[model samples]
Target: MATYIISSFRNHNKHVTYTSLISTSVNHTQILEEFHKFQYMQTKVFVVHGSPSISSRLFSMAKDVGMMSEGYTWIVTSKTTNFLKFMDSKAIESMQGAVGFKSYFPKSSKFHGLKHFMGLKEVDYDGMWAYDAVYALAMAVERLQTKKHVTKLALLDHILRTTFRGLGGEFKFVNERTLLRPIEVKNVIGKGDKRVGFSIVNGEFVKKMGKTNSSTNNGLEHIVFPGGHTSILNHRRLQVNGKKMRILVPVFGGFKNILQMVVDPKTNLSNVSGFCGDVFNVAFNVLNHKVDIEFVPYLFEEGRTFNDLIDKVYYKEFDAAVGDITITSNRSRYVDFTLPYSDMGVGTLVRNADKSIWIFLSPLNADLWFTSAGFFLFLGFVIWVIEHRTNEEFQGSTTQQIGTTLWFAFSTLVYAHREKLESNLSRFVVTVWVFVVLVLTSSYTATLSSLLTVQQIALKGGSVQFQGISPVKAAVYNNVKLNEDVLVELRSADDYAKALRNGRVGAIIDEILYIKSVLALYSRHEFSLVATSSTTNGFGFVFQKGSTLAKDISTQIAKLREDGTLKALEDKWLERQSSIMSNDFPAVSPNILNLYGLRGLFLISGVSMAFALLVSMVYLAREKCQGRSKMEMLRRVSKICPTPSTCTR
Candidate 1:
């Protein structure tokens, strides 16, 4: 029985060093022919493997083993064949040779083989024997277990002189880069459980199903070659078989482009003159060439300002701008533009607090009604008191009842209270009063509820901070005019205002409403708005003309637009009162996104309304009970007093 182990590694790019170094090793055909020419009696070689880095480590072990010594015939076996077939063959034939098998790993590439059914799909690993050989050598040394002060050279002698069983087979020392291991061949069991004869050790067939121990009674059955270190098996048991080209896309950004910022390393675009839609459409088409896109962002950095980044005709200084770029007549002379994706719109941004429900429920709004109710009740009390003072006939009548009844009407509206009466006429009055009180209570509650609802809706909608901002002005100020106008890019709104005041830039062109509001808020820095013939310069990609890639991309973009996909993206971003850059500004120091800002305002308002209602109900109920009890007690005491006719003045 003759067996040889082989493995090899080479650069994927097929570098020259790889070819030169790997060429020295034996090929699969040469290895097979050598095996056929076997002149030796029962022999087996367990090959070791390591990549570029691991190969160096194996070389160190070989030096200590003296495999490279002058007297030794150093025959480094590099046969790239699967030795399993030699172990398995009845006459010595086992497995197929394959190359580039690392592709079978789970992450890199995927493959399905016959062994996959046994749960061994991604079992491919590198440098297996370089490490495994160390284990086999360690086991052999453990078997000796001698404490006779063994030196490195003596230990090397001990290993090379003994034999033992190891993971590969019968562990025995050969020359450098080679290990003689006894092979164990088992019968081939068919998928149906039919078994055939197989080799027991080193390619020799043996039938033994009982317990077998590799260790002998005297010592271990495997020995290590102390002077020899294993080599990194580069050539594996495989052939190239085929070749194909594949396109690869590395991940550039995170979180699906949700936070594509102007200052970010990737997607840094120049000012382009286009509405938000056109700029983003061009950018998306360029980045993603897929025909069918599930989602797309509406506003991107390319259209962030009105600047043209791409050059169609050609210039010397720069090529194109990715973010918003100024599109001017000069720019048109040099560059081309794609069809407009969406028109720009100027809109308002309102604060959430201004439209909150609490704002409408404020005391100021209800003050007039409360005051009217109080004044009427006061007038009725004063009239009843004056009538009692001036008319003798009216003195006998219950002026107290009139005052109390009138006051109760006031309390009922502002607070919840009812009056108690004794006379039959008073009883009739009280019944009517209760009915009127219920109706008034329901009306006030309903009105308050509706007002609160409207306030809530308004708050949710938010107050427009800036109204009707002109994109044309923004284009001019952002230097989107390019060579047509001498304008500087304003990093921030404040900077633009400063430039306007300092007369550094001709005019601060921006969305008009935002500038107006900003100016109003600042009180300094005033500039005149420069009006221009606004051309709806849509943002577009600047690709080499007649390129097939460009054509394919344009088709995909058109499909996205036709199916309302682009519109959906627009609705997602443009409908918002503020842009992403606007919300991210440092003024407010919002710890989280603006979405949290809106939602938090609603949550606080709802909680406050609920709390206020609870307090108001408690206060109203207590006041009502106290006023009625005090009035009834006074009436009872008056009835028990001395007769009015005989009482002293």
Candidate 2:
């Protein structure tokens, strides 16, 4: 059975680590110590092949070493699982959540009758095999008795050729030595076991154990692993045989909150702690098995880059590299990277706009402001023309009339105008005008409020610069279409702040991860994220090419994202620093509303005013022609149309 298991693993290109225990010579402490040594390798699966007594001892030791937990798997061979019914309750409890292989046989009426004859409630595989062996021998001896001369050789030949339907299926031998039997895969539950699937002759899982004979291939049904977990455990490869994995961490001095390495003087061991470190540690802890790791700090020397740190992983000098390493296409050619754990994009950080007294007019562009003013004046004139002859409010002096008109036009902005209209035409005009004013006022108020509370940033057509150790930063800068001569490069987060504040650089452009680090140091009121271009992938952990650990850790990162752990970590570290810059302040321009947007409102107001003026003129002309002839009425209408010369007078 052990050889078969080894061969199966070899077929799949998986490495197998084997160990043996002698029941007579190996003590309990020695076996436990051996299990303890395996912990350093982060072995997630274990296959046990031995007698029931030896398997029980191995399971007990495994539970002691903490291997029989949610993330671990234990598989026992038929030698032990076949006799699980006879094992004690203690031994059975220790093997809970274990997967086992047992010999399979179709039960028949004759098998039940034999059990009843023996007065036994249950019969194990061993008892069934013994019964079949005795029956075969008895039949062979009876056939030999019929022979004239019987010898030991003749008796053996008869036994070998014997074939019959026995309690344990067909009593037949294959190749004169091995039995042709199928194996049933079972999982240990509370003091018992349940069949999960079946393994055929080629070690392939062919069927699931259920009412439906659904065929399966290469895998079993859902398994309840240790701790009653239904999710499959992640299978990770060992970096070194039972040794602590060497991990390289960058010793960043500027953005310590992003990635930092500190050493303890007493123990002389490096301790990695920062936003990146915490994220990596959280993802590592949720893996199927814990790997022992040693953090070695790599101090950034002159001209050293993040690529150098990744090269160490590529060359096998370190098992992995954990930091704020940006995943780029160029770097990905030589090393593998886990899924990004941070926000992805390139952001432009610039100085906040200064508070101006004319900030209220900043929400709408000049064209919109002028268009709105013209509509207001036109509506005021239409109302005055419609009501001046009938309403006393419009019958004042020329100066008073002009003042009233202007007041009415602007008062509609706040819905505080108290003028009453006597004519239906005037009322219609005012109603439509009031609706237009309401919409304009609401939009203006909302925009002005946002501008007042949140600091706005305007990226003028100025020189752009980026600061980072990644070679991809240059590619991102070129993608933004900035002139090479105007590009300035800085080193640390402090440099970015100083350049932006002192007017050394107009705008600093980099990934959102590094831009956020700058925002954390300074007040958000002074600096703001102006624009974001999603031109680059985000930050990720680096590993050697084709390393399985990279895939395993990437899976864990995806889980963290789904379960909200990644967001919680972000809030704990990065979000708290820039909480003032919440969702209210998005990376958009303050001049959002324009003349084109309010064209519909202006059109409605203009049509209403023009209709009011036409109706008012027709009413006045009719009033004048009430007691006159057609010729006199025509003369009066002609008189109403003043000449250009009379206008000068």
Candidate 3:
């Protein structure tokens, strides 16, 4: 009955938490071991089941552990109470003070005499029910004789609706459903179940009905609890009169919003805020309890790591340690931990490559540049040889000839080599050279323009100096590879950024999840992150190794996670979690028509246009001077003048 009530309580929106479920199929030792697995939940409320023998051993075990007291509540079920039919010394000795209820108790005078005559110590409700069922069947058979036909289904239907006032209260079957009956509540005292109270059909336990505060005994005998106590024990809140709970909080810094330590100016009281505190607060509220939490800064004490802080709980220094305390195997050995509330891991924060004036050259490798240069030289050489003798513009002294050859070869780049081809071979070679230059220049100009237009270029290889210590440093080594490997030891994230800006450290290795907050905290858009290392553990509340509050707190945490409270806390503090692990660079598209790329074209056009204007003016002036025919002057201006074979040598 206790198990049913407790289990039903859990189903009522999980009003309670059952930490462990032990089956009777297991051996005696396994059962005890299973019980041992649940530690000090501060307040112990045990629901014992199984036969009298099992209950005897379990109560013996509970008694050995000091669980038999007023602070504890041990309620057994009908099976346990029924096991007490004989009330042997062993059963009574182990179950001296327990509470249980029996389903029914037959109270007929004839049945009572028969029980007494048969050496039966208690009411025979089971016998009475069986006897009633037999008489009812006999009555049905007698009625069957009156009917034309007798059917078992009809008899069963008649039996199902049968009603009577028998040993069991208002014995009735309505549509195959038994009418609701109240279970008698009893206290195990002096080898028998003593009626201390009764459970009503409406689900209320009346310990003493119609009693006031003025009544000394509340109209009931003094009830005894196992281990001989009269007050309820609560494991969560210690035995203080609602005083402030001393919660040992970690003083370490740099977990951006999850935990922050502060001192009240007016009261000088240290307060803890952030996701951890919020989660604890919410969990406590869900459990319908509260503790006046006083954040005690103890992790700040000299010569202490987080393990030492966990030790405080193991030694019962304070109620619990609240912070981003990770749950690990080593830690579990010393102190109990609640279920993990936050997922965390290792990540890296690094300075991106610096952008410089010549950053425009980043798109192409040296091979491409060298190859383009060699190809241009080859084209110039090929054009010079093809145009030298036939074209007049290529005829000059040795130095002039070399200059004109180079000029003729290079000037075809923008279709500005004005000397017309005299030979078809020279025109063919020039046409092909111009086409090659067009493609090369067009591609080069497009690429360079893209490189320049981007306001910021993501830096890479040989520039960043990684700095962090230990497993994180090791993680960085595994996750990131540098061109110039120089890992330095650094302090805080601010130091990391300062180092990057001042050209010191290139990157900082830390938990990626934490570094994300750092990036958002500082708004370091220039920085880049490359993280892949998985974090081994998560944050949880801590408790004494045997503390049962660990189970209760864990249950509440699981509940919080299920109902989105945990997620909401994460969202509240870590709202700006960075996505730098993506490592995506801005997509660079070629800008072919930018003014910088077309500067040479503009210069050449202006110079050529100026020359044409000068020549047209000169031709018009000469025409006016000689009073020559306009058509002759126009032809003179358009004609290509022949070069002297060797420049006046």
Candidate 4:
């Protein structure tokens, strides 16, 4: 029995066949050593058998030995009916019988002979080897690595590439469809007597062990698959002769908050089962259905930047790319892009600042404050006039009246002094108040007014409005600060317009229609138009440049758009955000825009006025301390103060 088992493991069969039966006391090492010799000779048929060893362990040992020896291999398991009875009593005595061995395989005597062998089921072996064989054939054909079966390697190569479903696995060349079959696991069971056993429990092969699968007495579990790991090996057909082609796509980027890098698993772009993966799958389906081509992703490292990856693709190392890439003319000139898969625009990502929408409304921003200030200013001026008008208006000792009037004017400007002085005002003085209010108000308005000699240049303080364009441009302009890429740059509309006028920038970008209109108004003599490429695509496919695939893909893209599929995706990703008032808005209050605009205005005004008053007081005090006449101080004041003129808006 030992000699028979050894012969079985030593390539005794001309055809590749494996049997599970093995005899007790067979030399396992000798069997492996002999098998290795057969493998060196490129012998494809060999059996690996070990008596008293579990089938799994024997197979594993055989695989390792065969791989090292460069040969195709098969494995056979031992069948033992009365395992306890077969336990060598002499060997047990030699080992002092203090130990016992529990085999990982079933101890049923019915599981014997060639029929009960581990790999006797051809299905198991076929599945296990199909993937590897297919991949080997494809690689060999691609590299032209074949023996001279024919006069030239071309005939074999053609055969290899064209042969589909030649192996156990399902295969398709034209459609790029493969047998996506799952591996089945079978559990062996014993029959009534010794010489008969069958696989009883049928289950699918699982990569992971679940909590629900309980332990056996030996605390060991077996993984059984119809086709072992080898079944799903890399089997792909090149199919060069057909019109159909395969395209490679590259992906990159990191979405931190949206999807976790590690925890959520799917958030990582490189994850084959992630969101990006789903996107690739969809793109593949679209491309494959339309043109009978296959889309394979050159999946590699994924991060926030893809410059290095683009370098690879641009060099023709990869076919194309689809992930997060900022589209620009420079990239377009080098590589072709389908319309934009999605929009890439800037948005306000407010952190801690107040974000109220009400602040955006202009009038409500200062209606209350202006009303109160004006009311008090009117009251205070009237009261002051009444108190001193009895003696006569502007007729008091000029020095004292001037100082009092200055204080009244400054106080009214700073605070609501009018509300405090209403009690002192008389009816006749109120008539004079109307003229005073008109004269003072005219000098301060920021209009096309020539009323004030100072000609106040009201620098537009942070109210971004480019009449015809959308807010997205403003947000992008504020965020993007270009460094040194010469072929492309992002600039604000104002900067772009300036550049265009100055003949600095090649082109000014806006909405296509908007830019066209602006360019129409300009003379042809100023700028020569070269080319116009879409920088940000709303909906497009990406493909290899100059390839007819792009045109075909464009048709499909249009189809998807017309059917509202594109719109649905847009709504799903972009427009699906909750209302602005939702919790995701922000923790801070929302009045910051108005507050920012108002606070800046008031701060500048207050500081300027305060400094002017300080300078005036200094000049007066200096004249007095230096014993100069009051006339000198008056001269300085007249030099500093401006004569009022026509008001502007």
Q: Write down the RMSD of all candidates, one decimal each.
A: 24.5, 15.0, 15.3, 28.4
Deviation (Å) of 322 in candidate 4: 2.3
Better of 2 and 4 by TM-score: 2
Tens digit of lDDT per residue, candidate 4, span 166-214?
3333332333323233222222212111221122122222322232234
Per-residue C-alpha lDDT of model 1 across residues 1-649, encoded as one tens digit per residue: 1111211211222111111122225455554443332211101122224342222333333344332222121211222112222232321111111111111112212223323544663332333334346765676577568676667775576667555543233456676324553222221121111111222333333233222433342121221121222222222111111211111111112212211333224745322222243434454545543332222122324343222223221321121223233234444544444444433222212221234455433322354445435434643343333333334433454765575546654654454444332223323333444444454445446555554432111212211111112245444434433343343445444555554454455443444233433433443223322232234354344322222233344565677688877656554544332322232221221121122323343344334434444554565588789999999998876787656664444
Instruction: List ranges where model 1 is wrong by over 4 Å.
Output: 1-360, 363-371, 378-406, 411-558, 561-649
Off by over 4 Å in 2: 1-254, 261-273, 278-318, 327-352, 462-489, 503-512, 528-538, 545-548, 551-591, 615-649
TM per candidate comes to: 0.24, 0.54, 0.46, 0.30
Cα deviation of 12 in candidate 3 (Å)?
22
Alpha-carbon runs more than 4 Å astray in model 3: 1-66, 69-248, 254-258, 264-269, 274-288, 292-294, 298-321, 325-355, 365-368, 382-471, 481-485, 512-649
Q: What is the Å distance of residue 602 in model 2 from its true position?
A: 0.3
The residue-by-residue lDDT of candidate 2 on 1-649, one tens digit each, is 6777788776885546445545645788888777765664455677888899888888887887777877777888899999898899988898989999999977888899988998998888878888889998999999878789889988877788889999977777667655656789999999799887887654467555333445443466777888788665554445334567888988758787788887789997777777888889888877746667799888778888888998887766677899888888888888889999887767778888678999889888899999988888888888788877778887789999988888988888888888887888887888898898888888998899878865665546556667657654576656866667777878788888888878888888887877787887778778887677777888999876656678888998999999998877776767744564543345565565798999998898889899889888888889778746777877776687667576456
Q: List the residue pairs that clash in candidate 2.
A: none
- Give the per-residue lDDT of model 3 (tens digit) for 1-649: 4566667755653334344555546577876665554333343566766676667777777666655654567778877775566657766776766778766553557666667788977654566668678766776676677789878899887766676665554566643754455566778887577887655555565554333333334434567876576444456334333356567887656553667777789998787777787888788667665456678876444556677787777766677888867667777877778888776555455555556787656555665566545545555555455556456777778898778666665677777776766655445555555655676577777677766654322343324433222234544565555433566655455666777677665455565445655666665457655443454455788976555667888999988889888877866876655243342342333433344544464345334434444554565588677766776776665564334444344
Give the lDDT ranking, best first: 2, 3, 4, 1
Residue 292 CA error for candidate 1 (Å)?
Answer: 22
Compared with the true structure, the alpha-carbon lDDT of candidate 4 equals 0.37
TM-score of 1: 0.24
